[model samples]
Structure formats: C-alpha cells, structure tokens
Target: MASKGEVHVVHLYPLQMSIYGDLGNTRTVTARLARHGYTPVLHRHHPGDPFPEKAHLVLGGGGQDSGQARVQDDLAVIAGRLRELADAGTPMLMICGMYQLFGNAFVTVDGDHLPGVGILDVTTHANAKRMVGPVVLTTDFGEVVGYENHSGATRLGAGQAAFGRVRSGCGNNGDDGSEGARTGNVFGSYLHGPILPANHALADALLSYAVPLATGRPFEPAALDDAIADQARTRQIRRLVG
Candidate 1:
C-alpha cells in the first residue's frame, strides 16, 4: 500500500477540553501515524476559528460541565461543517463533553438547555449521580478499555447504535449497558485514558479511514511494537475484571 504524504488531523477546543489526559489521544494518533509512514498534520480549531479546510481525522476531548457551557455556542458555530464532514465519512472521535455536545442537547441540573450539533442521536441530562471509574467494553474492535468520570447521563435514541456495550462501570447512562453513541464513522464516548493510548484498534481504525480521504492513498500500517501498551492495558483489564 502506498503511504499518504500527509493526513490532516483536526483537534477541537484542545485548551478547554484537555481534562483527564484527553490530549493524549491527539498525541497518540500522531505518533502512531508516524510509525505508519504518514505525515500527520495537526490543526487546532478553537472557538470561532474557521473549521480547517482539510481534515482526515477529527478529535475532541473531555471537559467539565462549565467547559461544555463555554464551548456551547462555539460548537454551534461550526456544527454544520462538522455534520458535513461526518456525512462524508471523515472519522471523528468525541469524548465526554464533546460527546455530549455532539448530541441533540445537554440538559443541566437547573433545567437549562444547551443545544448540540445533533450529529449523534443522543441526549445528556444531569440527573444521575456521577459515574467515575475504570471501564471495560465489548466492541467491534474487541475488548476496549478506558476511564470515565461524568454525571451527565446520556441516552441513545431508538434509531441509534452504541459504540460498544459496557461490561463493567457506567456507560452513557447508569441504566443502559451501552457505552457510547455512533453515527456512521463518528464516535462519541466518555472514555478518558486519553483513550487512544489504551485502545490501539480504535486509533488505527480512524487512521485507516483518514489516509484515503486525505490523500487518496490506502492506509498501509506497519507492525510496531505495542508490548508496553499491551502490557499496561492487560494489567488494567485484569484489575477491572477481577
């Protein structure tokens, strides 16, 4: 497979949504892309900036409710462009706060309504107690794991499909076994182990979709040693499962 000369990676609201090592996902993606012989170009899209004209993979991180409020209007400003990208099969990974905003709306405890981009068929409400802990999930990528700390209970719509099923810990909502929302290649989850570092499959899948879209070249992955990450992931999974 031919390598893409470059893949544009867009990171939204990095400064505001850097909670719980969320920025690690961006770092991990770039690092992994390098190993695959592709140059990863990063573009940071803050509130009011024009959405990058070039984007292969888009990422967003976790943040507090307050942070979400701060980005609410800004997200609205770029929602249309994001929706367009999603429809075009540009891979997107939205965690926690971003995940909530990508939904229909996020209802605060005070009955305040924060509108969302409606990319995912889901809604979040601040009613359930905070669910914070390590999580293990059964997904199409096999076993995926991460950490989640959020009080905003999310519910997937009837027409929606979950990103994975929770095997342990609260996911989406305390009542549902679902862990995240999925619309085409757009994925929304609360996982925060900088997520990509702990889940290689997810990261690689995003890159596979990205290279072709960005440079019209198929993604040819190289075999890189992930022994350290694999070992760490194994220990965490064991601790959680045990």
Candidate 2:
C-alpha cells in the first residue's frame, strides 16, 4: 500500500490514565491508520514532558483517583494549548477520567476538587455506586457499542451537544439519556471497551477529521474490509441490548 499522509497522534498521559484497556484506543488509531494507508506518528505526552506543537489528534484515557492527581498539574500546564487546539478543530478523544478532566471540574467523593481544562461544558462528581456494564448507544455515526466502568456522574451544561443517546446502560450521569459530550471535534465519553475497536465508525470519523488537518491535503478514505469487525460489534451489541 502506498503511503497517503501522516497523522500526528498525541497520547496524553498514557501512563497515568490508561485503565480498562483505554490505551488500546490509541493502538486502534495506529492500526486503522495503517489500514487506511496513512503514516501514523505517535507521541506520548507524559507529565512534565513537552507537548507536540503540531498535533492532528489528541487521545486520553480513564484513570483512578491517584492517577488523576498525578496528571492534574501537567494537564493544567497544557490546558491553554489544548484549548487552542480544540478551538482550532483538532480532533480529541477523552475517555472516562480524561473525560472528567476535560470538563469544568471533578469533585471527588471526599469533596476534594480537581480543576479541569474547561474545554467541555460539563462537570463530574464521584458517586459511591459505580456504573459498570456493556453499553449500546445511538449516535450520528450509527449504533455504537462499548463498556462503561465509572463512578463519576457527569452533567453537561445546558444546550451542550452530547456524543450520543444512551440506548442501553448508564451514561453520563445515568440520570439523563445522554451519554457523552462533544464540542467541535473534541469528544468526551465514559465508554471504554477500549471504544474504538468495537466502534470503528467513530474511529473513522476521528481519522477523517484528523487527516486533512494534519496533512494539509484532501481526505479520501479508502474502502477497507471491516466485515469481521462489524460482525463482532453486531454480536456484542445483540448480546448486550437484546
């Protein structure tokens, strides 16, 4: 396969916030990029490390409370740059803990406050009862599937567009039918089955947005054989939803 172009993916705090196979989201991107004939250049952005100035896509994962604390300060340091990238339409996928951190604040069960980047118009509070289950959602990309394991109940600000509607399972706060938050190309969600492998459409959407921005070229996604992946997703969704 001929190389198309390069997509610069920035993995934010991979060490601190990669729980429940969230790091697979980043791996999925690289694999899909290879399938799409794009050069995948991955950069891991750890705490106290320099963030890449030119990033096409930003990915982050969930973490425990301790992990969140570890990256809190570094996240603050890059908050301004992140905001700039977000406003400029860089595609970002922030899952679980990262999702909470992208919001206004995350209030722990003990009432300790962790400030967020304020990118997404949402707030999260830790709940004693954790929501853990396989999830099925109805998104603009079509029916999406994943697994959720979170104690944080996130509430979106009024009029904020959600990533999807919950078809099954507890999402966002488990009070609203909404599941995730979205602004521009930035996406926040509690879904974790590593997310992307089970929901390739969402990954494709992210890549489509990323390619043009990163390479300064028109994006024409190639048709790839996704029959196996599609079947797996169908089975999982059927098992979970039916």
Candidate 3:
C-alpha cells in the first residue's frame, strides 16, 4: 500500500492480548526504523475503538487461549477495518493468537468452536500433546529461529504459506511444520521471540514492503552485525535442542 507520507504501525490489543515474546515484533519494526534514521510512529488499539487506516504495517502477536477468546470478541468489532487494510495491501505481521483469529475458526478443548477473521483458509484443533521448545525453519530465505508453545493442530490446504517444512519442531498449524504464513501483504505465523532480532532478513523483508510506501524510495539491503549473526546462530542451535 502506498503511504500517506509517514510509516504508521499499529499494535493491536497488546495490553490485553499477546504471548511469548510477541511484543518483540513491534520492537523489531521500530528498532529497524530507528537504525534507518526514521522515527516510526506506533499506535495501539483495543475493543470499542476504531482502527486507524493510515498504516503502512500492522502487527499482531501471540497470546494465551483465554486472552485469544477475549480478543476474538473485540476483534470482531474491527474485523471490517482489518479486511479493508488487507485488501489495500498494507503489510501485516501476525503471530500465534493473531494467526488463529485470522483463520477460519478455532476449536477449543470443551467442544466449542469459534469463528475467526476468515482471512486464512485454515483451521485449528485443540490437541492433548502440547507443542513446546525451540524451532528451526529452513526457508528459501534461510534459517530462522523461534520458540513454540501450543496445544492445537493447524491444517492448511492449498493456501499461501511462509515456510516449507518443520526442520526442527512444531510450527504454525501445530503439525510439526511451518514457521509462519504469507498471504497478500499479510504474514502470519507461530514464530515466537517476536521473530526479527535474530531473523534480520525477515525484518528487512517486512520493512522493504512498508518503507518504500512511506518514503517513496526503494529499500536497500544491509548486512547484519557479525556478533549478532553469531548470536542468532547460537540461538538457532539452542532452539534445535531447547
């Protein structure tokens, strides 16, 4: 989406929703902007409020089950706005709970099914075997690291996706696969730890979509710090086992 001058990023339901290091998603975007000599304007929205449309990027992160249910109720009120933004191609990055809500529906443990935002052609089923620990994803972009913790089975059928296979542990749909998903300009996934500080390439990819719209200039790639790169590798190794 073309920008209205400044790059605006909105963090939805941060105070009430979000799990893992989901907030790190926001941090990744803002920090990258700061490094590029731009001050990113961040906003937060909750239930009973209207989401502003002047956003270049929208970020939603992971959260707990009960929190997810609560936010689902609130998100319904602004579902139209979210759809509008997606339709306009404003890039979005959504994590666990956010991913779940954007899907077809979520089946809870007690046999109750809840409708979602219907953005992704997928469904989540509660499972007894909890998914936890570090995850290693081998993508065309390269390896990325993040933690996984969930109790559900996610199934995707012939839709947009972010990863190929679960190189290490359970991923997006809780089926021991995927790091996340990509549909249009929206990227949803289960990569925890906010998925940027360590995955600089991802941060760059996301910013490449938003910054050009905001500044009317093409994105230029840069190298990650050697120390940071080493740390990220170490983290990946740890995730391989931890």
Candidate 4:
C-alpha cells in the first residue's frame, strides 16, 4: 500500500520506447500530481525490470516499429499483469505504438503480425502511407489537441467506446471519424504531442481515477491556471482546422 500523499506512476518501457517526445507525457503527469499536493513516485520499467505490484497510474508512449519489435516480447510477458491492473481500475494512458500493442494485434505493412496484450478490443493494420499531422478531438472531457504520426490504422471492436470523435486529421484510421479507444480506466490514443500538457482536462480525468485507487479515497484535484494550455490547444486546433 502506498503511503498517504504518495502515488505510484509506472512508466512502462521508457528506455526502449518514447519516440516523438512521448516521455513528455510522464513529465506532465508528475507535474500535475505534484501541483495537486501529491508526491508522484515514478517507477520506470526497463526491459528486464519486473512490473511493480502497486501502481496508481501507468503511462506508455509512442515508438517506432523497430522499437516496438524490440519490446514486444517483454510486453507480452507483462500483458496478463496489465489486464489485472485494468480490472483493478488503475488508470492507463497508452499512446501510439503502445496503444496498438494494447489491442488484439497489429499487422505490419510487410504482413507480419505483432501480438498485442488484448487490453483493448481493437486491431491495427499497418499502411504504407503514414498519417502525420496535428489532430483535434472532441472528447467527453473536452476538446483534445495533439499530433499523430503513425502508419497503423486501428479499428475498435463493435460497441467499444472511443476516446473521442475526430474533428480533424487522421484518427485511429482515416476511414472512421473515431479516434482512439477507451475501456474503463484505460485510454489508448495515437495523439502524441505528449497529450497531457495541452489537454489538461484529460490529464485531470486520468488523475481523478488514479488518486482514488492509490489513496483509498476519492480525490478532485484543485484547478490550476490553464490559460497557457488553453492557448496552446487553441493554436493547435486552429492549425488543424485551417
């Protein structure tokens, strides 16, 4: 059990992954927790490290195909544990490659299939042409702004709740207006401008889920001055819209 004011945030595969400033997500999480008066205990899990037994939140970031391949086996080993955490209501934010790997499977452009952890009922098919640009999404939390760069087009299972509706840019796939998938406390998305820094509402939602599970009490973090974040989001949304 974590001590009072101590929240454990596990960063999965930080060394092997985190392409496109994905590590910034972890920094954002830590900063938010600290601002809310909680001590964020960051646990970085490398290839060989065992997954921590107690985690309030888990963050996984975007990676390239080669990076994904390198960590696939290690990820497979911990897949079951991840499912357990999800069942226990631990908040998870999986971005890009990590999001694909959390699903059923990802088929590469070369036709090789990479087995996923099956946390989300989705499948990704790699395309020769990559989708790379600023993305705007209207989510339950609010308007989310980020950038996406991926070759995988992910399709959610029937009846699965999407993280949001795509307002602009190619989401999960260019075909569906749906962007990302959410199951319970787990959220998977291709949005990779580190996500949380600009989308503070989504960040707070993740924290709302985590603090309760970690501290054995419901928590609503004190609101911070988000004017700058809002401005950044507005600029991104405008760029995407224009």
Query: Could you give candidate 4's per-residue lDDT for residues 1-242 as a string of tens digits?
Result: 33348789999999767877989999998999988878899999988679897899999999888888999999988988999999998999999999999999999988999999999999999987889998999999988999999999899998888999999988999988999999999999999988999999899889899999888887757668999999999998887775
lDDT of 2 by residue, 1-242 (tens): 67998899999998999977999999999999988889999999999998897799999999999999999999999999999999989999999999999999999999999999999999999998899998999998999989999999999998889999998899998888999899999999999989998788999999989999978886667788888879988998788777
Error of 4 at 9 (Å): 0.2
Q: Which candidate should be chosen as best, given TM-score against the real structure?
A: 2
Candidate order, TM-score descending? 2, 1, 4, 3
What C-alpha lDDT does candidate 2 achieve relative to the native structure?
0.93
| Stretches > 4 Å off in candidate 2 | none
* Segments in model 3 whose C-alpha atoms lie over 4 Å from true places: 1-5, 162-164, 173-176, 220-226, 238-242
Error of 1 at 167 (Å): 0.8
Q: What's each prediction's TM-score?
A: 0.97, 0.97, 0.88, 0.96
In model 1, where do residues sit more than 4 Å from their true spots?
A: 1-3
| Candidate number with greatest lDDT | 2
Name the TM-score of candidate 1. 0.97
Which window of 10 residues has the lowest lDDT sum in candidate 2? Answer: 214-223
State each model's C-alpha RMSD to the native: 1.5, 1.0, 3.4, 2.1
Segments in model 4 whose C-alpha atoms lie over 4 Å from true places: 1-4
Candidate 4 versus the native: TM-score? Answer: 0.96
lDDT by residue for model 1 (1-242), tens: 55557999999999888776889999999999988889899999988888889988999998888888888888988889999999999999999999999999999999999999999999999965989999998988878899999999999998899999998889989777999988999999999987898789889999998989988878888998888888877888888886
